[model samples]
Target chain A: MKKIVTIAREFGSGGRYIGKLAAEKLGYKFYDKELIMLMSKESGLSDEFIEEAGEKITNSMLFNVAMGGVYLNPGYNNTLMPLSDKLFVVQSNIIKRIAEEGPCVIVGRCADYSLKERGDCLNVFIHCPDEQKAERATKIYNMPEKNIEKEIKRRNKARSSHYYYYTGLDWGSPSNYDIVLNSGSLGADMCADIIADIAKNC
Target chain B: MKKIVTIAREFGSGGRYIGKLAAEKLGYKFYDKELIMLMSKESGLSDEFIEEAGEKITNSMLFNVAMGGVYLNPGYNNTLMPLSDKLFVVQSNIIKRIAEEGPCVIVGRCADYSLKERGDCLNVFIHCPDEQKAERATKIYNMPEKNIEKEIKRRNKARSSHYYYYTGLDWGSPSNYDIVLNSGSLGADMCADIIADIAKNC
Candidate 1:
């Protein structure tokens, strides 16, 4: 029943909250903001820089070269990697290493794609209605009501495109995920419990 | 690809709208209200009775007996079947018949479960945030704002319980369907286009 759970979600969908709760319920490690910090430490990149670059899709040919088998060829110098490519591969390696260590709950950052080949992983996407998301944004993030929609759209675009660039798969598509849960319908805590239940049954 | 698309959705998620639009784009027959009518005609039961019993989880012992093996034995008379059991079996049969006919879009009534055995079917669950759903309820159904939450919860409960009772599966679990789409995020029209694209790829 030890299964890695990867969650991809829309902005303000309570994805991070649900993932953290599920991880707690499952007694598994939760990764979200901490993943960026870990990447920064591992790559010797500033946490701020990693945070910014992490959500943005890189169009650089360097990313393509790195994804196209740079890691497979040991002759390539790791330090020579572009910042985006370095962050991507480093985070990917970390994700793989974590999966090898044990079951955990990971939120965002294309974790689903990172662990795509693992049969023991449960990939989920959490989303909600825009108005509910806006409310959450206003309440949880203390975001202005007027700016909620804009922020949501901006974040959604960044995450989806980032995922697309990395995985070559459409974000939130049913085929790419094991299940899609609407946090607004199930509630964050209940959604977490459901994910934990699935982990237990897995 | 010719495929049967089954949608399970929240009340104000614009599921019917998306299904109808997708059916139109795909040039496929749309089933929803027409399905209830079809069941009434086939089973000789009043549409009102079928409709009421359709989404209600019946506790009648007759339903259990009928489900147990009434259809297999020659001694069981069709007239003696409980109304709920009759509706269930009739609708199940109808769904199978429709799926066999050709590619089409079916909404609600647990069409996903009815067509589960078919490899050529795409199951989708549509949902929205409570606020967004409430807005839809107000505009579309003319539901008062004060009563919107109550109505949404009530309808959601009925749909999920009906699905659970019939399919022995959790409603809206991503594992149960190929994909779950949030209308609040993707919008109704885009969701339909995405479903149509998936159907085509299928």
Candidate 2:
């Protein structure tokens, strides 16, 4: 049985819901937005700040240049690190700690890349067609945007950029994940069921 | 129940094996290389020629330019159509006819694009990591290539180009398929099981 399941998803793809259902079916702890709370508590950063800056980087290149000087120091002082980099380190540590605790489902926040060294991790990506995503954003997410499609695209771009910034990997690339499921076509429940089944059997 | 299942895969991903297993489990007819015979009988092309040029295009751009003159005629006179285009049309018609008969599993030949209009079709793309694919090619396929990795890349590129030439869509894009399974991680049996389960319940 797989010990760790990481779900990376497109915005408005109902990925969090699928992760929750799969975790319930597998009887594993589920972490999504809860990770933000954990990170804030662990890092002494405000919850609101962690939520805002956790998964969305403003400019990765600039951040990299700014942090370049600090890389030479093996001691790696956290005070010298940028706030975004510090948050990522803290979040990654928490995720690793969670993995060590037991089998669990973690959604978003680059858990797949964070736990890449683990032998028993199952990485999944959930995506949907743009039309379906727009509909879900309006109906399920209740987003108050005039152009929900544009909003969805913007958020997805942010997520992708954030993922790339941290992991140096393309977000949502099938090669990076064990399985990629379309919630629109398979339905969220079936997607969750498949994840649970694969976790149990594979 | 899904009446049609279309699989697009990398060259050495064991996609055909997975499709066959899924079809058997679902009690559906499976088509892979068998479609070559059907196409040859319908198009009067030799099985050998179809096997060589069926899924690999020589040069799609030149073929497109040569066939451009025939597009104005809605009747699409076969005498004026290029041999490659003729082969594609015949193969697509055969695929459509097969779908019309009943539930079936088709491997390659862009069956997903051919049945894009069908509401009951499940399109799946199976992929594997390069290392795993190389190992499979060397061991399971018994390929006699000194550089198996290069051979695998060449075959995959040809498949991608052929797919793009015909469908004007990326072959393995997640949005174009319902689910993309990685056989390297999930194992072929579990991948087949997931496909069959999704087809039956979704």
Candidate 3:
């Protein structure tokens, strides 16, 4: 049986909810937003800063490319790691520590890539159609953007960018995940059930 | 229950074997290469010709673009539909007719896109890691290619191009399918079990 379950998902795909449900079904500890506090405690970084830096890139790719020398130059490199990179290091350590503790569900924060070395990790990616995600953003999350679809796309892009920046892997590629599911079609409950079943059997 | 299960797969993913196992578990009819003969019978095209045309494109995309007018202009059109397009129409009709009859598993030939209007269809995309696929090709299939990985990639590209040319949709994108499985991670048996479970419950 798989011991560690990592869920990487698109924005508004109900992946966190599915992870929580699957964790509950399997009697495993669930970790999502709670990791922000842990990162703050471990890294001595402010919770607010960690929260933002954990899921968003501080600089555009162009800016990073233009300023690459500043990050690598020894003269400018005294603890010169970007906040996002710092948060990623802290978060990855925490994820590793958590995996060492017991079976648990870790959502987002590139946990899939972080725990990839573990033999018993089941990594899943959850996605839904744009319309379904927009509906969820408006109806469930109460997101107030005028163009919810555009907002959804923007958020998804941010998440993808953040993931790729830290992990050097495409965010939602099937090769990185054991299974990928469409929550809009399968519904959150069935997705959780399938995850749990796979965890037990595979 | 999802009565129609359509599987679109990457080359050497063992998707066909998974589909067959799922069909056996669900007691559903399995259709794969058999569609070639059916298309031949329906279109009065030779089985050999249909077999080649059903899964491959005759003209390159550049050639098609350069010669678009020849296919569209009434003066030049007299049943000028490309052989692939003709095969697609026949195969889609047969897919629709099969879905109408009863629960069944259809593998490849873009059945998922063909049965988009059906409420009971479960569209799945199965993929595997390149190394695993290469291993399968060399060991199980006994392929003679010295560079098996390159051959596998070529075949996958062909499948992707054919899918995009006909359906105007990207192959192996999670948004286009209900679920996507990595046979390398989950193994074929567990993948089939997950598919059958989803078909029954969702």
Candidate 4:
């Protein structure tokens, strides 16, 4: 059977680039935000909304806490409760659809939890230090340094909440992920190579 | 902080033996049945009964189709349910307790799941060939050769069920573990040494 690789990651961890490199190296299809777009098409929701709410349970911690978290009205619902739920279901359905298609590299959106029972799947989590994240975000996305910090915090909050909402398990726990990579310390290419080797062995 | 080590394994894989050996090499406490015994003592349950119940989930799975599984009578429900729940809660609590005390070697019962958040914890899964299990079971336990196949299947059924029930996740999935070792191929001592080295690095 062809192999399925799922990559869950922190923002600015270079997971997308690493996944693309892995796909190119092994000649596999890559899925990232592309998955969100597909889910949007299927759910009849706008891609922009999916992009913003795709992998998050809350907007950001500060606002979430200030506005009673899930109680805040994101306009889709008085509290966005319905929209968030539908968005996750849509993403989950889309995830299974992609897994059914064949071997591919999936980035984020709790794809690991979606494909847990597949014997051929390899789940990887990519993480890096805060400083490294700020540096990378500033360099790649061309954001101001101060804004990079806020952006990093926002993305991480979203990723954690998204995973928690879906998997109902602690995110980044070594127990939840098969392999955890220190991408900032190891370098993205090295992390990708490690994953590729692990895929072969696994 | 002292390192933590978690060993997840299949039944008849000699996981406990390897864990003990690794602990000895590193001067860490080796906990196998000792953990159950400790939990029983802490929870005020008899050791024998708790031991039977602690791993009975495995036994149930093995014989589940034939025997629908053990359910405590309505009167015993209040007590036995807490026993079962306490087994897991105490297991998790003890793991955290041990990590707080110092490094320790924990075998089976999903210690890896228990210590997922500890930075120093080295989670490992010990595995071996099926044939090796049959060979060892017959030689070590004096099991009849004819019954070895049945024993292996039954034990695995129980183990997977036990692990899954407590961990709330699929068991024996390589991608869900940090490292997988073929102890039957590598030899237990070598496996222990290699694991010890890995633990040191962690």
Best by lDDT: 2
Which residue pairs come into collision in candidate 1? Answer: A129-B129, A179-B174, A180-B174
Clashing pairs in 4: B58-B158
Better of 1 and 4 by lDDT: 1
lDDT of 1 by residue, B1-202 (tens): 6389999998888999999999999999999989999998997767776777777655567654654423332336534555555577789999999999988999988888988778788778888777889999999989888877998989888888878877899886665765687677556876787678667754
Compared with the true structure, what per-residue lDDT tens digits does model 4 show for residues B20-117?
A: 99998888888888888788778666777667666655433444333333344355544433335555676788778877887798887777787777
User: Which residue window of length 10 is worst by lDDT in model 1 chain B?
Assistant: B66-75
Model 2, span A82-171: residue lDDT tens: 567777888999999999999999999999999999999999999999988988888878887698888899999999999988888999
Model 4 per-residue lDDT at A109: 80
User: How do the candidates rank by lDDT, highest first?
Assistant: 2, 3, 1, 4
Cα error, candidate 1, residue B140 (Å): 0.5
Q: TM-score winner among the candidates?
A: 2
Estimate, for each residue in B152-197, the C-alpha lDDT of model 3 and write its tens digit.
9989998999899888998978889999999998999998999999
Docking class of 1: incorrect
| Ordered list by DockQ, greatest first | 2, 3, 1, 4
What proportion of the true contacts does each candidate reproduce? 0.19, 0.83, 0.87, 0.00
Give candidate 4 misplaced runs (Cα > 4 Å).
A58-81, B1-202
Error of 4 at A72 (Å): 20
Residue-level lDDT tens digits of model 4 in A76-142:
5564554566667678778888889977899988888888877677777777777888988899978
Candidate 1 error regions (>4 Å): A1-38, A42-202, B60-81
